[model samples]
Target chain A: MAQIRLSSISKSIDGLHTLNNVTIEAAAGESVVILGPSGCGKSTLLNILAGLIPPDEGQVIIDGQDWTNRTGRVSYMQQKDLLLPSRTILDNVSIPLVLKGTNTKKSRTLAQQHMEEFGLLGFENYYPRQLSGGMKQRAALLRTYLFASDILLLDEPFASLDAITARKMQIWLKDFAHKHSCTIIFVTHDIEEALLLANRIYVLSARPARVLKEIALDDSANSTMVKEEILSILDSETGDTYN
Target chain B: MKKFINTAKKSSALFTLGLLLLLWEKGVSWYEIPAYILPAPTQILDGLLKHHQLLIYHTSTTLLEAVAGLSLAVILALIIGFLLHNLRVLYTAVYPLLVFSQTIPLIVLAVLLPLWFGWGVLPKIIIIVLVCFFPIVISFLNGLDLVDPDQINLFRSMGATKWATFKMVKLPTALPAFFSGLRISATYSIMAAVISEWVGAQRGLGYYMTLQQKSFAIDQVLGAVVVICVLSFIMVKIVDLLNFLLMPWNRNQLVR
Candidate 1:
């Protein structure tokens, strides 16, 4: 288990500002959601945390260590399932284990053991195309989980899924995260999703996204009141004061 | 119902071919065209039957060269594509030259091959490789490029090394494109072998055709043409089978 902090992270791509002094932190075993408008550099923030891209400024500190711009320390899942069409679902999920130098047979066996838990038991030999969209997303999540168990960075993973399926997946994920007790930093444009899943929600402002507000929710908190509050904050332009 | 449509579709093609052959056969007899000028379908069939042993021998020789050259070309393309993908400098340096190689007339090169390598199977194989490798390499490189950037990020985040990413993602993603190129190249392989044989060879359908043409054996020449088309068609079917076997996901029968 690992706790990660992106402190004052800022990035500019080809003279275009993507993220601006965005600071966020997730405690170990906590589910933190970054909610923002579309194209608000939510994915960019996750990418920086994943160590795929270095932030122009600030540091990525994981567990009191400066782990800036270093990859393979965390599991990451992008929006698209991105399953290798050539491989079966079993082989696809086995890839992370194989890449980590586990033997092919052992990797497949390990992946097979988790297939049932992920709701992909019988479809082991089936290709990605044969699976439903929700199933594919589950497989992708499983692949990410298999890569690392401590921390997971998911960027709009269920965004493309249809509403009913997406809702089911969100509920399933909430339970899964609880069961696994892994730290999760899930980025999404859906406010409802953030509120539903997060221990703490970081609402981000549009392009050159900065953290507008951080709200920690408890069971006693009024859902309707918080939803309205976050909605008002999101709709309001940056630099505007809101209670 | 689908099977019926497939059968009808196949019969439609056969019907068209049969009608064309009938017209050609009737027109030759009605117009009193000389056999030496354009052999009728019946005459070509007769020629094929009479020279079956000789034609089969020559076809086997041609087929051998084509298969050998095509196998070598595929291996070379894979090696070159891998290198070109990794070494940016080599890609810029050699990629255009590969395109340039295509621009030079195969006929001209066919003539020159024998001069350099002498009248042997090696020259013919070389000619076929030159003809077949370009498409394979280009399609493979295109497939590699087609991989999603996020997919690469996913792999990197999973602790996959550069080589592992290539082997697991890029290479498999490239297979469909590579097989498509192979399909095109397989058809060309036979023609390329025949073309090289036309320049110089002791055996092969092309060499046999040249000999028959010198003696005004036009029926025999037509027979060789039929054999060439059949061989090329067979090569394409073989490639399709390989594609089907290797890429089951590409099949239309999705369970969902």
Candidate 2:
């Protein structure tokens, strides 16, 4: 597992500053959550980390090496499951391996081995349309896992699900991350979700987003106190905009 | 309930056509209308059976031209549509010209094509290609452009190369729209072929119909119209079947 360090990342699109000197870090095997209001450039930060888009200024270091604007180093799961609707669940999960030049048969066999672990064992032959939302997200997660097991960047992966299903998936992911001992950087606007799943939470301001605060959690930490403090930080930032 | 409604809708269409045909047949006989103006259904049927061999020859000629032109158009549209999509500068330069090309009446081309290329199958085919290629290329380009942005980003984050992303995500995603265009183009293909034949051709349903018209054989002309309708219907059905085979995932939506 590789630790990730995103240092002073800044990005401007079409003269609109989206991110402002945003620095975030996660140790190996740690689960970090970036919590912010909607449209606060949280996804843009994740895109920078995933190397899908280059930040105007940043150094993305993983395992002590600079990986700036370099792709294929981290696995990314988008908000939508984005399973290829044309392929069966088995084939969808096997796509990353196939794209990496693994033979189709070999990739499918590898995917099948992990089906039971993802709670998608019986739905291998089912198309994406046949599966429920929760199952689709699970299959997507398995695909991300297959892409690279060391580091994961997830952008609101459970945001589209119903509340009950979303909680269930969060629980499943928390356990999965702990068991696998992989670095996970999750982005979401849901504060409760951030509190529930993250070992440490980074609260962000609104547009031209900057990290407002980083809260580390333990058994002794008061979640409500942490939540309230995060609220105030966000509230103060919101106040600054109006002023 | 939806399925029942769909079946009812289809049956209603059939019933309406049958009723109209029955009224036409009865009214022609009841009013003692001259066959030269409008032939009765039975008279048309009689003429179809009498000239079956001749009709078959002309039908085959039209069918061959339509199918050949359509196949050529499909191949060229896909190749050119893909090129335009991949190259932004080329698309910007050429796409407006494609739209501009559609404004010029194909009938004008039909007259001049034989003069330019000679009165052979080549001119008729060129007219069919001109008529059918635009819908396919434009629709396919729309599909390619409208692919989910997140899906492309997801593939990119997975280290998928441009070709890989195109094959796995873009191509399949664009198919339903492609088929929609193909269906439209398929319907037009036969009509275009026949029109070219009408302009000038030695053998085709269009030529046969013109011959019947000159001799005041309205029943035989009606027979050719029936063959044209049947052939056009068959072309659309073939496109539908291709869509079904190529896009199994879209089958459920098709049924709906």
Candidate 3:
């Protein structure tokens, strides 16, 4: 059974279509990346899957259960860190459990267990304002994980990071996903990011976006060959060469 | 080095105050002004020492009224602010009324309050509540509404309910601004209480000053004025201390 599925999803804003009849599914523990140019509605589709924004017409099923129009089943992290400024790192990471009605002590202990995994153990007492940009993003990712959902939706989570930090995070996320065995649906504009981290990639066309292609990366010879293919497809759709 | 710089700042502030007192003394002596016109600083200090017990009694009454009024205002403002923040229609409906209430002069409020409630603590308390409530509500609503869209979306995607999002994000973020408004309202509370007492009252520092003024006891009046200033400063300092205790993150940003 698919861990997360969006079938015939359609989203419109102010009478203009943003997503049209989009259908996608990720099996349990599978990692899929959605790739597109700006305004391709990749984020919108992710939002619909996460149940943040309801689709005009569609059904979303998670773990063989219909979850359309429901919230809190999928853990979602946005591009910005969105760490609560007043909360300490530990408190921010523990927010998901707190919202789920866990006792404070239990939630803290649970969050503390994952702090070392994210390299945030020592900075537990630090406020968000005291953290570096990379640390803040890591803390945010930890928050999403602590919610303990079976599926994760990440919308350009590393888009704001410097290139070096983004590369490091990509490696860390891949390792983290493997260890946790959670399905991940990631949205990104960078073909390189999709190539490096995704098991499969879905290319989306511009506004009123529809899926143009779905490339299986597991069969590719190596990362470089996958990158080239994705770049070519993006170039053809955009009509602009990417070096 | 940081400690030395802080000490130097304190010394400079004291020095400026000393200069102002010296000028005040010299002006009074050179002009040979009558004691009734303006008492010298030393004469006012002497009056303060002589009438200390009486001043304390009056001050306690004013402080009680101010504290009670300000406390009630804080509670009302928080409830109203949270409601208006969550409901857009209520905000649009009542926001202009709040602004309009503030434009009505305080003196008019003082006079009207006594007529409605009779000359008592109730009238003075009402005046202070009127003066302090608007700013607290306005600042709190502004802060609560300032919850970032990105943050809201992030929580929404996590399947958080609207109440959960408010509790975890909006409330904590709005606290700094709420405390700021409280601090401002604290000072206003003291001033409003005293001024209302001046319009009509059997007790309070304002009433004491009015009695001294009628008797041409200029030094005593000056002493009462000084006490009022000190009370206001102390309330503001207390609010600052409360802010430090509640929001320690802001303390590091405060310049020495």
Candidate 4:
């Protein structure tokens, strides 16, 4: 497990700041949610943490190691499932192992064992086109899980799925994290999803986003009053010092 | 009834071809058309039968030249396309020139090739390669360009090397486009060979057609054409089979 901490991270794209002096941390084995309006640079923050892109300023320290403008440290799954269309479910799930120079037969065997775990048994030979949207996402998650053991950055992984599937995925993910014991910095705009999954939620502002409010919810705190408070915080001006 | 319908649908094209031949034979008879001008289908068939040995030898030569040039072009195009994709500076400087080269007709180039390379198989094969490689290079470049950025990022996060990403992602993604380009090139390959052979060649179906045309033996010329058509269809089927073998994931959609 890894602890991810972003310290005063600032990013600018084409001279316009997307993130400004924002800091967020996911403690070891913690499930952190980043909540914000659409296009409010929530994904950008996750990208920075995942080392896909660098912040113009500030450091991404994973487990007390400063890593900026680096990659390959975390399992990063974007909003889309991003499964390869050509490969069968088995091949797709085994991509990380296959690309890492493992034996193909061995990779398929390992992936086969986890296919049952991911509820994707009997789909080893089926192509990506043959599966439902939710099945593809599960396979994608299994692939990501197989890539690394410590940290994962998921950017609205279930956003494209139907509401029913999304809820089912949320429950599955919650249980998966509990069993796996990994740090996950998940990005989403859904309030209930954030409340259900996160130990700490960072509510971000619009363009040139900074954390507007950081709410810490206890495990037993599943109250309507808590939901109302977060909604009110989102409706009002972000509590960032102006400019 | 269903079986009958299926059989009818399958035979529809052959039926049309047979009907057209019958009509041509009737038209020639009615018009009192001389064999030298427009022979009956039976006369054309007789030409094929009489010259089968000579036709086979010549057809073999044409096949050798076309297949050789097509294989060389595919290899050259892949190497050149890969280099161009990697070297942005070179691609920018020279890609437009490549596209411009295609606009100059191969027929026009066919004349100059025999002069430059002599009246041999070399000129014909070279002309075939030049005529066919352009579409391949363009399609490959387009395929390589359309690699998904998301997939790239995903691979990068897996700590996949540049070569690894290329092998697993970029290469697979470019396949459909490469096959697409291959289909176009396959259609052009035989035509390009025949067009080159039109300039100068001792043997080949193209040379036979030219010989028969000069002598105004329209039936023999038509026979050579039938052979050319058969060769082209075979090439297309071969390419389709290769596509199927290489990409089984696309099999369901590939046939229909």
Return the TM-score for each candidate structure: 0.96, 0.96, 0.95, 0.96
Q: Lowest-lDDT window of 10 residues in candidate 3 chain B?
A: B247-256
Tens digit per residue, CA lDDT, model 4, B118-190 = 8889998998899778888889889998898989888988888988888788888898898889888888888
* TM-score of chain B in each prediction: 0.95, 0.96, 0.95, 0.95
Per-residue lDDT of candidate 3, residues B123-214 (tens digit): 99888888889888999988898899878977876667888889888988888888889889998988898899999999998899889999
Candidate 2 residue A79 Cα shift, in angstroms, is: 1.8
In candidate 1, what are the lDDT values of residues B66-179, reduced to their tens digit?
Answer: 999999999999999999998999999998998888889889989998999999899999999998999899999998899988888888877788898898889988998899
Please give me the DockQ of candidate 1 compared with the native complex. 0.82
Stretches of candidate 3 exceeding 4 Å from the true structure? A241-243, B1-6
Tens digits of per-residue lDDT for model 2, A1-243: 338999999999889999999999999999999999899899889888888788999889989988888888887897889899999999999999998999999999999999999999999999999999999999999999999987888899998999999999999999999999988999999889999889999988888999889999887889999888888788788985221
lDDT of 1 at A210: 94
Ranking by lDDT: 2, 1, 4, 3
Model 3 alpha-carbon miss at residue A136, Å: 1.8
Ranking by DockQ: 1, 2, 4, 3
Name the runs in model 1 displaced over 4 angstroms.
A238-243, B1-6, B253-256
Candidate 2 clashes between residue pairs 3 or more apart in a chain or in different chains = none
- Candidates 1 and 3: which is better by TM-score? 1
Candidate 4, CAPRI quality class derived from DockQ = medium
- The positional error of residue B64 in candidate 3, measured at the CA in angstroms, is 0.9
Determine which window of 10 residues in candidate 4 chain B has minimal summed lDDT. B196-205
- Provide the overall lDDT of each model, using Cα atoms, as 2-decimal numbers: 0.91, 0.91, 0.86, 0.87
Tens-place lDDT per residue, model 3, A78-105, is 7888888878999999988888889888
